[model samples]
Target: MSDPAARLGLGLAAIARPAYITSGRSGDLGDERGVGTLRARTRELLDAGYAAGIRYLDVARSYGRAEEFLAGWLADHPEVDDVEIGSKWGYRYVGGWRMDAATHEIKDHSLQAFTEQYALTHELIGDRLAVYHVHSATVDTGVLDDARVHRAMAHLRDEGIRVGISTSGPAQGDAVRRALEVRVDGEPLFTSFQSTWNPLEPSAGPALAEAADAGARVIVKEVFANGRLAPGGGDGTDGARAAADLAERAGVPLDRLAVAAALARPWARRVLLGPVSVAQLASNVAGAELVLPSGVDDELAALAEPPERYWATRSARSWS
Candidate 1:
């Protein structure tokens, strides 16, 4: 039972890059070249994470060779039991490793697949994994009531492993929320859900609220709006402006204010900011140390209302 509050800056402490989880297919990310150096890189990143107070790490089979690299680091590493790992299943890969060329895709959420996948990854990342999130359809598709998906995930939880789904967007969030409301197995079958919550596409609001009200864990990805929230090209300019006004009133920076606004959501457990550098990671973690004053926080909240339109017609979202 790791401290949830500590896990607050807790989960997915911004990953240091050229470890882009968003890109693949062209780059030899998991090839011999990448694998040779990845473990050391991960160790460096983990050291930085510890310094920054991040206790949870999220990885998946498809995230290049991330898990295998981590597996190497945590094997006899002193930090083995210090952090939490939340990995996923569903997308089958070639070889046991994610780097190999695709033999085929299982694409099935069967209980057998889930259990087997979990065992495969679990065998690699045991004490490191504190949670298991089914990685649902993420490539321009949505998750439905796939019974196999449900049963396999439930199987994981029944074994005492915390199970959940890291949904893609509003569509999946809607499904997950519905499942929770109905209490599939006398209670919400899943303990957590990962989705979007950014100024660009704030569509996660309704479902997020529902899950929160139900006391389900709401882990957010793309909180920085895929780095658009940073002050550049005025990408999140409108959101940033609204955030700035909120920050001014609250006496905080836009980034800190933005993440704090997310924390304001009673159900949001953590915001994942997968940064590409140590500097970027620091900015995100610094957000948690900030406690906005009431007057300022209130002002920031109001500013979010008027300019919601600016971010609407935008595309080319970044989930990294």
Candidate 2:
């Protein structure tokens, strides 16, 4: 197998904020979720990931100071300059550092949002930001059709930063296809895409493949279904049970199998690992190295849930 580290990227979604929607976070993060604690943890993960040969790092505005943490890390490690950084706009963190906040984030795809968030992101990430994405873009948001946003994104593209979109919800495929159709001056506005794709939620696969065919970079996120596909998660779900059985037969941990499955996608240019600790990162890295038995991928296909059901389960997960 090719080097797993080369195709892997570390995402700061879970570690940069005190609370997130990922399952098993209560155990993984414990009660020490203060800003300082998570900042330190983020640095530790960054150090470990870099040492392990990961060259891509993902963050976003709604990740609650993720860009700030990453900026500090970059400043402290000026000599380590080979990594590619990607961040997203369109959402502002409103959790207020409280787990019980009424809303964690607010999404706005208006040109004003793009302008404001871009300025904030650039202030923190500077030119090290390689790609800027519209966070959680959906068809209903109408961001794909907003000409003003496209012009701003095209400006960023002209400045050598790749403009992209990250899709969410059950209509991820629809969003991806719509993003692909967006053009600025006869050129495709989006050249990169990040979307949720895992054994239990592979509905976006075809659209992502089409993006790859259009020469866009396709990054896979939520490969473990926000921890549902991880060991001891999704305890009552049939999809989880099927995945667990497959992992046992393959002689790997459930999370490892999940990572392996995401990496198995032919169109996936990079897969983001949202591990909260060094141990989990190591296991996920190991998964990237495993050569699955023949027909394992096909068998895993049976684990997919109806898109609506899969998304409903994800939406119902509590912030921890």
Q: Whose TM-score is greatest here?
A: 2
Candidate 1 per-residue C-alpha lDDT over 1-320 given as tens digits, one digit per residue, 9 for 90 to 100: 24323535332222322223232212323333344555565566666666776776777765555677677767757654667678877666443333333332346555666677788788888755768877764424333355666666666677777777776543555656655643346656777777666554556667777876877777777665544455331344555556545545655556665666666666677766564345556666777766666565455444442223533423342322
Per-residue C-alpha lDDT of model 2 across residues 176-230, encoded as one tens digit per residue: 9999999898999999999999999999999999999999999999999998888
Q: Residue 22 in candidate 2 has what lDDT?
A: 85
Per-model TM against the reference: 0.72, 0.98
Q: Residue 313, candidate 2: how far off, in angstroms?
A: 0.7
Candidate achieving the largest lDDT: 2
For model 1, give the 10-residue run with minimal summed lDDT.
16-25
RMSD in order of candidates:
5.8, 1.1
Worst 10 residues of 2 by lDDT: 227-236
lDDT of each structure? 0.58, 0.92
**Which residue runs of candidate 1 sit more than 4 Å off their true CA positions?**
1-39, 91-116, 136-144, 181-187, 233-253, 293-320
